[model samples]
Target: MAAAIKLASDRGVSAIELVFARNLFSLPVVATWLTLAPGWRAVRTRRPLAHLSRAGLGLGSMTLNFIALAMLPLADATTIGFSAPLFATILSALVLREKVGRHRWLAVAIGLAGVAVAMRPGGASLPAAGLAIALAGALGTGAVNITLRQIGRTEGVAATVFWFTVISLAVSGLGLPFFAGSHDWQLWALLVLIGVSGGCVQICNTASLRLAPVAVVVPFDYLQLLWAMLFGWVLWATVPGPATLAGGGLIVASGLYTVWRERQLHRSHLPATPTEL
Candidate 1:
């Protein structure tokens, strides 16, 4: 993610271009693997509308995130984006009718406070366009997560990923003629690397979810912020301000608390002993 952000910043690539590059390069590989894999079949959906909606939201999220990366400091962009999980929590309560306790709500509020700290007008003074892009990305991500939760019971993960890539590629391709421009070999290589890394991140994320529950994996995501800061400094000499650091720390802490609370809830609902085990 940090590498992709650096590439976007350096190349002045548009969000749509980065998204197109990602899906154009990665989807074919995923589709081919799915085609060859045993027991693979076309995803049958009673609710095609829901599937399409989720795919659209996913594509929008990716596009907005790319735009934010291009426009904001890597650390600030990443930190602000981390608020997506909090948005997801709130959305899940409203959309999924999931019971969210007071504690979780408090955590969400605290996390948003962190976001405010990072985005305070005089502190970092990130361009309004960048802040808007980041917020849009976070909201889009929350929508995608809610839609995924609604349809996940009926759709295979690979199918969902595949369709998202298809939608993203199609949408971006439609706009490509307007934004098309030539790039040198170096920029092309960076774009390729971004695409590859994006694909690998998705694969790794899927693998992690399969290996462990989401609560176990989510906390590790905070490490991305650290990586973003490091990459920004090393590559672009972008050092975050004190307020940004404080805000980022609060966001990470709140996120970790949310994960921990989720784990506790999961454990509480489990039977005292597993009959199979």
Candidate 2:
């Protein structure tokens, strides 16, 4: 999805246009699922406000990411975006009031350091604007993660995915008139890939949060950095700079530690045997 965004933006699609195209094309895919698997009634929701907030946050994250992809190296943009997990860890402690042990705190700190390293502040090598935007996108992603968990408690996974996409589609539709453009066949193909991939990802993301604790689930984002790096090379003939590699390494390690620590903590709290239960 990130790659397609880069490809489209390179072809002169503005970030807003990409957002609208994503939701516009993806809406049908989501609607198909809601119709066939769960029936249309699955989308019934009483929480318009929560959905609205989600739509806003989701759009913010997607827009920032799309812009970052245009301005930065693909690998660099992706690694920074993957910083969402670190942001999620911090948010869980402060906003959710979850007990954030020193281990997780340390992990979050290291992960942030990774972001700084990858960004390489005070360097002329990369665009500072893109770095800042990518980080903000990551922050937006973290906020979305927390919001999804809250909504998932009361809403079914299908409803949560359906409403966010629907709301985002509507919101982006309103903005489309301002950014409208005629695309050639190539750009249209990229937009289609963006929409389909984005739709599949939305379902996977909502289901993952509904099925697991947020911390445990979000840390898997680290794996994306690897794919991003590979795609970065294939699509653009670009290899990550030393700073990006160093920073990406830290981000990956921090994510792994966060996930491992969560699992360990969960194991410690579980009863050892049926007799204990």
TM-score on alpha carbons, each prediction:
0.87, 0.95
Candidate 2 residue 162 Cα shift, in angstroms, is 1.1
How many clashes (backbone N, Cα, C below 3 Å) per candidate? 0, 0
User: In angstroms, what RMSD does candidate 1 have relative to the true structure?
Assistant: 3.4
Q: Candidate 2: where is the Cα deviation over 4 Å?
A: 271-277
Regions of model 1 farther than 4 Å from truth: 32-39, 42-46, 203-220, 269-277
lDDT of 1 by residue, 1-277 (tens): 5566557556776666777788777865666656776225654446667767876788878878888887788888888887777777788788878787887888889888998888876644679889989988988876666666666667666666667667777888998887767888887777777766766666555545445433345456778888888888988888998878998899888888877887888888987886635
Give the number of colliding residue pairs in candidate 2: 0
Give the per-residue lDDT digits (tens) of candidate 2, residues 1-277. 9899998898888999999889888888898888879888888888989988888999989899899999998999988887898888788777777687899888888988998889988874888888889999999999999888889888888888888888888888887888879988988999999999999899999999888877789888888888888999999999999989999999888888988888888888987988766
lDDT of each: 0.74, 0.87
lDDT of 2 at 23: 88
TM-score of 2: 0.95
